[model samples]
Target chain A: MTARTPDSARDIPEATVARLPVYLRALTSFAEEGTTTCSSEELAVSAGVNSAKLRKDLSYLGSYGTRGVGYDVEYLRYQIAREIGVTHDWPVVIVGIGNLGHALANYSGFRSRGFRVVALLDADPTRKDEVVAGLDVRSFEDIESIVAEHAVSIGVIATPAIAAQAVADRMVANGITSILNFAPTVLSVPDGVGVRKVDLSIELQILAYHEQRKSIAPASEDAS
Target chain B: MTARTPDSARDIPEATVARLPVYLRALTSFAEEGTTTCSSEELAVSAGVNSAKLRKDLSYLGSYGTRGVGYDVEYLRYQIAREIGVTHDWPVVIVGIGNLGHALANYSGFRSRGFRVVALLDADPTRKDEVVAGLDVRSFEDIESIVAEHAVSIGVIATPAIAAQAVADRMVANGITSILNFAPTVLSVPDGVGVRKVDLSIELQILAYHEQRKSIAPASEDAS
Candidate 1:
């Protein structure tokens, strides 16, 4: 294996990439609590991961904690934030202003964590001009103009399953390359487009699978 | 490794466990499309996973596709459903009537996918008796009776960050062994209780991380 360099985002394992946000959150918690420095064990506990695994994941980003002295909390937090590209806010547009979309629009976490909701859109004509999260609901046909205006690279789809694919197609055509899909359907995007599906039912099913096992065999290991 | 047995949920790897629901969904789609059998490649394409990984994941549950015939769609679907313990609907309770909670209550996917929302709960007195998704919102103090009456094993925490821990504590005390937390807080549960967090901001941050890398080096591989 070649030696990894700092700021080199290439070739980082996907698993490590997923955990980076967890680590970033933990670092933020430490900094919020006035913590200046912390050992790997401390950060791992805060992030709900084991120390060795956390260190290995961090190593991919070229962050190595110092021996005995530990890591500087604020500096490490910034490094992770930069690595994850949250150092600057990214303008985002939400398509499908339904119940889930309304929740996403009013979600304060998005604005506080590196994303700004530039628009809320829906296909219903009645929804137009309605204010949500301080943004007026716009027609889905306005995607092209919205993307061009705000330079939105990320789009969120909270539409029903039947409409998710069309919304994704429109988003991709309008130059929104990254998607966070809450719809319960499989989306097909081109080679360069990125799509992430958040299915609440699937998550609950996973938990149910484990819960069933616990009842069958009480001796089974607890889910951490 | 020792030879695996069917219906033995004791040692299924967590990674494979996570993907079981995805496979189940793909199988459901195939069944919906009137497909009686499907090759691993076809199923993998539907599930957005590689053929080898899908096969390996299924193998953990003692399911091996025939050499030429592939897998029997309905049988495989039933096996997965039984393995995931979703053959019958599990009773669930939601402990917040806010925007996200409202969305969850009205989500039709949960009812169709092995879960029934037995009660909608809120700590706010004014929210009591309010109807949501055809169910009356109940007081948070009634969790114990509600859990006992419906035999609910799963609880969803949609409360704010400050109230999540207390809600989780109450759920655990009332025999809800599994929790799906949407609050942006790290919950501490005792052993034998399972907690899964769904953070919208964290998911967006992950997408932003990769999206940032894409802009930095367009030559980088696409996020799958």
Candidate 2:
């Protein structure tokens, strides 16, 4: 998975890249609370990861932390933002207009970040009457025109499981390479096209697994 | 951190454990489609994991699949379920009764996977009139009694950001050790407790990160 492109000084590991946002989020909290610096242990506690692993993950991006003291909250955040390529605006499109889709379109986080929701596309003509997050819902068949016009590379699929793959295929055919699938089913895309899934059921199920373990080992003080 | 007990290989890696439910969901889908057996490649495509990684993960649980053929869909599903402790009933408490909370309480996935929603808690006294997921909204003060009576080890925090930590603190005080946080904040739990967060904004931010990368890179298709 670390297959690097030519003339690069080795890329960060995918696992590490995933953790960068976690660390960035932790740093953001510290910044909000007026905390200027945080040791690996403090950051790790906030991020819900181990301290050593946190340091190791940060090391992959070069030493942005002071050796003995800690990492500067704002500085580390900037470095992570720069590495994540969110310094510039990113145009995005949402392809469904269901209940989940409405929640996402109404989400203000995208606008706060570098992402701009360029369009909202729906398959049903009846849904065209709907306006979500201040944007009018358009027909899903207009994806190609929306992608070409807005130069959208990222698409969000909040449609049902049956419609997810078709939406993904259409998104890919329209030249969109990255997708965030909220659908329950798995999606198959060609290599180089990134797909990150946010399955609500899966997350809850994972929690249930741990909840089961806790039931067996009911001793609260048992770190073992 | 590698702070392992004398029996180290026994404790499942948290990362691997997270992926197990995904595989279980995929397996359930296969069974629903009447697929009795499937090769690793086929399962990987449906589960959204690398085939090699999936095989490696399954190997840790012992050889359950046939070398010449593949895994028995029903057998593998049962094996994964037993390993995850989902075969047994898990009592879960929903801490907030908002729209998202209402949706979660009514979600059939939990009932199918042995997670029973024991009660729904709400701080708002006026909401007692509302009925959600066929369960009447219980008062916040009933947490201790409900947890004690139900022996709830797992808790779901769907409260808003301002009220999330407070609810989590109360849940922890009532002996709940594992939490599924749907709020946007990073929760601070005591040692020995597990917190799995599902922040909609964070997931979108991650997608935006990948989406921004594609715009910067050339459009030429490199068949890597």
Q: On residues A1-224, what C-alpha lDDT tens digit does candidate 2 reach at each position? A: 45545332335787887777778778888999999998999999988789989988887777788988988999998888777767677788998877667766866666766678999999999999688788899999889899999988888998888899999999999999889998888889988788888877677678777666665653757566
Best by DockQ: 1
Candidate 1: where is the Cα deviation over 4 Å?
A1-11, A63-66, A218-224, B1-10, B63-67, B218-224
What lDDT score goes with residue B149 in model 1? 98
- Kindly list the per-residue Cα lDDT of model 2 for residues B29-123, writing each as its tens digit: 99999999999988888887899989988876767999989999999999889878788878989988775677677776678776899999999
Docking class of 1: medium
Q: Which tens-of-lDDT digit does each residue in B131-182 have in candidate 1?
A: 9999999999999999999999999999998899999999998899999999
lDDT of 1 at B169: 94
Clashes of each: 0, 0
TM-score of each: 0.92, 0.84
Give DockQ for candidates 1 onward, in order.
Answer: 0.73, 0.42
Scored by lDDT, the top model is: 1
Tell how far residue A173 is off in model 1, in angstroms.
Answer: 1.2
Q: What is the lDDT of residue A86 in candidate 1?
A: 93
CAPRI accuracy category, model 2: acceptable
